[model samples]
Target: MTPATIPSRFGLACVLGSALLLSACAEKQVILPGERESVRPEADLSESRIRLDGNTARAIQLPAQRVNAEWTQGIGSPAFRVDHAALGGQLQHLWEVPIGNPDSRRARITASPVVGGGLVYTLDSGAQVSAVTPEGAVAWSTNLTPASERAIDSTGGGLAYANGTVYISSGFGLLSALDARTGELRWRQKLEANGSGMPLVRDGVVYVVAGDHTGWAVDAGNGRVLWQIMGAPSVTTVLGSGAPATSSDLVVFGFGSGDLVAAFRQGGMRHWAEAVAGNRLGRAVSRISDVTGAPVIAGDRIFAGSHSGRLAAFDLHGGEELWLARQGALGPVWPAGDSVFAVTDLNQLARFDASNGSPIWAADLPGFVNDKPRKRGETWAHYGPILAGGRIITASNDGLLRFFSPESGQLVGQVEVPGGATTEPVVANRTLYVVSSDGKLHAYR
Candidate 1:
């Protein structure tokens, strides 16, 4: 479809009325027996000894007002033709904004949509950073200097909004802080010559990994560089690497090329760096490989995945390896009750015990639908499985949004977008927001 088509699908009129009718017929929440009794299902929570208290439960609760949240860069889209009304949510086509113009020069948007106050943010391959409203109007667009001679796909970097500022990174190697409301630039810093990982902000600090096997912690409140650590050995001499994670007082990360997991006292000096062994696949590979995903911090242990299919956990305090799970792992992980969700290029959805990385359930999923007609047996890949309201909401690459039961991983309902989905589903109030690859923003109940 041409960019100007503005397909009838990307409008509120087409879906709003249908969604309102469905929302008017609300489904009463069923009080399950598990809520009243303490009889925990073996798989209800991850296989950790730490008991989940009220605080933990409350932390994951849906907020009264929707806050822009992105677990990973983009949400998962399902590979199916769907009816929007059946998904148990209202569906409204908000807006369809075009990304690269008719000219061939265009940037592929791998950065996830960042929403805050009243706007959404994303970065495209053309080194163009864009901000838009939920209604699909462009707020501002700023182009940055390209990092290298070759174009790098910015799929993994994540965006964060804190205080009154917006934090964004270019896979090419740049981090900038901009005003949240207006797209005014506050400060821009070249974290490294090359940047591939997303920045994670906590407290008042921004933790990020540099393309050159180094990690830096900067004060978010003022954009001051607090400390920098030579994460792994030099990539030229050794197979250099670094993966970052953080808690209130501690900063955690792993470096397999240097064979270490290190911790630093927040706002203080680097405390210690301990080695973590290379798995069968080790750290570096022939092409496009490294430790890239953000580490998930749960209780006292921090869990992470390496480029090589190894999922391991380490002590948040001592930087010691607690448990390691060996499996054909792929992509970033999402932690729900007791199970963490991951999808592979082979179209497999696997849930593992977050504590020990033991497999609890695994299933092969359908691949995404391309713009062209799908040939027989062709499939699309799953991008994300966001957990909310006892259901897993996922977007497929082919522009379909689906709802699945967390209990069985079975698809419940789905909606198809004229433009396929490239971002993760954002759930606020009772509305689900999804962005499509063709630059269309969709809202569903």
Candidate 2:
């Protein structure tokens, strides 16, 4: 195909031996559940031209009136996506307080803080959990460590709040329930080790995905195991994963192998399974197929992204593939009324129509590129992007809190935080909260 015939979205062209791109397709390119190994890429998108497609651009229609009463979990409740949220006062820093530990060469913060019941909860190094008031006053604190103090791995495994209790999944393979207000330990059960993903609670059940990609459902009140499902880990994958998105009687999650599956919430029955990976065998860095981004379940549609380069939408009701975009995504996809906002791996902020995989707008952002030379085994860092109050809120590694207009993807506001935020900035009850890698929790009005 010639570049003139391709959609302007990115100047897509696949002229046989000339160039190729997944987004350059003329129509729906259906990738099935079993096509993971068959679809070989002769050329990757490393050389594809990426520019705003004037023909496909549409005015962004993000919901400006949607307000969230509380951010109870890592990705705003269960479905891992929320609509427009209300933010009051100027986008200025109100207060900052230390949480637990600082990010180091050996340890780092990867999970986001959650808020509920007039109190905000956070996890820190050494498996410590703390609760603070909306005014930044310390309410209570407790450590999830055992009597023998072995250095905790990913201590901030996952955090969730429900029914007046705070649920925590730890790196040492322990799931504990605590009093939301007092931080008193109610009960704890040893599950499996290296439970790095966040936990979510719904319908009297607490859900968690381990570092190995095994999903488990435990009793909300007593911590009894209800059901478990295991998935094989990928040979190469990303560092962290997202919480399982749940809606009604359905629960969906993407694995390290680029496989997305929908199962029943009550019995753990498999409803459908589909692979979301594309051929990235061209380079060593492009070989990952990790769906590190949380899947968004809105209404009857499911939106997910992968590191290998695929942004796909699916029909939730029938488990059928809807559409796919070749832009690689690594953060959570924000779904508002009719628009979806995401941070593409190519360092671009993009908006797409939720009904189909059509481009609305794209903006450039300095992505996770470290100019400094690494000595040996160095960990990766990212400036998490989120949608708040109809604005694209980002806390980059540069320690800047920037706000951009959703309509045009233009910079609107910027403020410097004490420490850079590696996790997504969270919003609740008309207030924005950002957790810094230095263990400080900053609240903005």
lDDT of 1 by residue, 131-220 (tens): 766566788876554444454333234466666677776655677787877777787777765554556676777766666666778888
Backbone clash count, each prediction separately: 24, 3
In the range 115-195, model 2's lDDT, one tens digit per residue, is: 878898887755788898989988898988887656545555678888789998777778899999899999887776566
What would you estimate as the lDDT of candidate 2? 0.74
**Residue 372 error for model 2, in Å?**
8.6
Model 2, residue 237: displacement in angstroms?
3.8
In Å, residue 336's CA in model 2 sits off its true spot by: 1.6
Candidate 2 C-alpha error for residue 219, in Å: 0.5
**What is candidate 2's CA lDDT for residue 84?**
60
Which candidate's lDDT is highest?
2
